[model samples]
Target: MTRTVFFISDSTGITAETLGSSLLSQFEQQKFEHVIVPYVDSIEKAQAAVEKIDRVAKESGEQPIIFDTLVNADIRAVIATSSGFIIDVLAHFLGQLETALGQKPSSTVGRVKNADRDARYKNRIDAVNFALDNDDGARINRYDQAQVILIGVSRSGKTPTCLYLALQTGVFVANYPLTEEDLEERRLPRPLAEYRDRLYGLTIEPERLSAIRSERRPNSPYASLRRCEDEVRDAEALFSRFGIPYIDTTHASVEEIATRILVETGLRGQRSQ
Candidate 1:
């Protein structure tokens, strides 16, 4: 049977339209014919739209699904209709509104709760996108507040590890490269030096490092085995001199590296995700 869905919203009609379009895209018409009507922007429009939907449902013998965002009288009348199912999404919105109001106004408690939730969600999407953008483990760091910072030479699996930590564990993970310049200077990057205790360095065998780089920049000096070995040794020596903790990422998967780093850094509880 063909299914018709309606999205009615008093406010954020664009949001309703966008979400409706996204939900519809998940379906293929060959298997299920579907329709999404968005932006029932007012009580009058919502009631009129319900009448139209009811007529279509009766004619087609199809039970329509109505996702309603109207929080006023029209929603009540529409819910009275018999030919379709009206889901009062506005009820949930109202519940959330009440919750927001019930908390103490102008308080850090309310602000921090909202801020942390927003940050967590934004971080997860960023992690997934970062994984896609830096698929080959290019040296990069974006999540600056990651509880567990990942330090590694180029192609030592730092990007994938940070992404996995962020996406799966919701742990903010910043990563930095132990570049030849930093190694030559016998110091960690200036930014990372401040968080010396939280830094978790990753090292890999020269041969594997060379192979991974060659795939990205073949025959270039950056991909040479000699450079890889030199950087690895220099980085390792610097870590030792600075007494910074480190990990060998030679055969570790993203999960393993993240887990080990969290565990060794005493951040198993401090960093989640």
Candidate 2:
């Protein structure tokens, strides 16, 4: 079934969207259409959001689900009048938090983005730069600085996973693309051989890899299914020979892949407030 979801907030709506996605993922039986309504900080903007949501509700014959991080009582009240299942995400836990902490929340609007002002933000930025610098074996000399090195065949999801780990956890990541020569040798590359402890492999199903690569180089040998199969098979064999742990990325989200790697490696992330 298809349902509409609205993520409304006074600022970027990132928190609302992230929380809504996490919650909605639990309901695997239904498919969702997501709409983000950001910068809804005023009564006027809130009414506009309500209008848009009501239109979807009317056309679909179902009330849209709203996940809101709106803090202004006046604006929130405007949203409450809308034809939707409103979930005040902050109010759900703020009262208990206030009582436990023996203080009231400042009810600050757009405070989530304040993460950019702290040391954690700089850490994430540095890590992202490192990922870009060392991507696809471009700067093998920097491998010694990386906490994790992802090795995989082209288009096997090495690049995005590395960036996700860096952006989310500040983990310095480097990636190497296993080329035909490296795969044929059935061993790690000379530069990578010394970093076996930090090595992690990623593999994807041949059919999917072929389709992905085909988008970039259609009808070329690089995108052929046979080539993909050969690359994946040989890559796995190399990982096995080196006793390097790996994961299949074909069906996993970046978050799932990155979380698993962090858990397995016991790498440190996110400094405490």
Candidate 3:
């Protein structure tokens, strides 16, 4: 049986969902249907949410679970009347923090308004734009501005990894696709020579590479197993010859690849807010 789980917040509901999901993951045998109700800043909206929860509880014959991040007392009071198990995320910790710090907390809704937060948000946006602008070796001249440069054969998870690094961690990530000619040459591209210290390589198993390529260009020489094997072999050789660190991306997700790069390069401190 599946239970209903509601993530309620006065803003995007991201905080409620993130924390709630982590907590729910502990129950491995149960299934949950999630409902995110965001921007519940008003009493009317909170009442509506409570009514919805109550209706779900009656139909499912089980008390629904609610993860609430509401900071306003009036709005929170309205939601408290719902026929569900309420977990007030902020209220549980805010008082403890206030006592520890010897100060009253600012019970604000949504993101905290501050100049530093605004700057960090802007940096994230700028990083995303930089990743897009420099994707797939489009802007080699801009390598000096990049925090990290990813190099790999086509569809070796370079583009997605670069974008993930930029969006999630605000790292200026750029990717360069190593073509057949570059592989045959057995050397780093001229543009990447000056930035060798920032270069990270990604390789994939030939079978997986061929499979991915065949989907893009079926029945073509470029998608052949022989071609895939040759490219990956030479790419790995090139990385070794140049003493460049690399990772096999055959089974790694974009998030894993980006995280590995950050950890390997000791750039975890560069992660964004």
For each candidate, the alpha-carbon lDDT, in order, equals 0.67, 0.91, 0.90
| lDDT (10s digit) by residue, model 2, range 36-109 | 99999778999999899999999999989999999888899999999999998889799899889999888776
Off by over 4 Å in 2: 112-116, 271-273
CA lDDT for candidate 2: 0.91
Highest TM-score against the true fold, candidate: 2
Q: What is the C-alpha lDDT profile of model 3 across 187-229, one tens digit per residue?
A: 8889999999999999999999999999999999989999999
Best by lDDT: 2
**Candidate 2 steric clashes:** 0
TM-score to true structure, per model: 0.49, 0.89, 0.83
Query: Which runs of model 3 end up more than 4 angstroms from their true locations?
Result: 1-3, 25-32, 55-63, 205-207, 268-273
Residue 261's lDDT within candidate 1 is 74
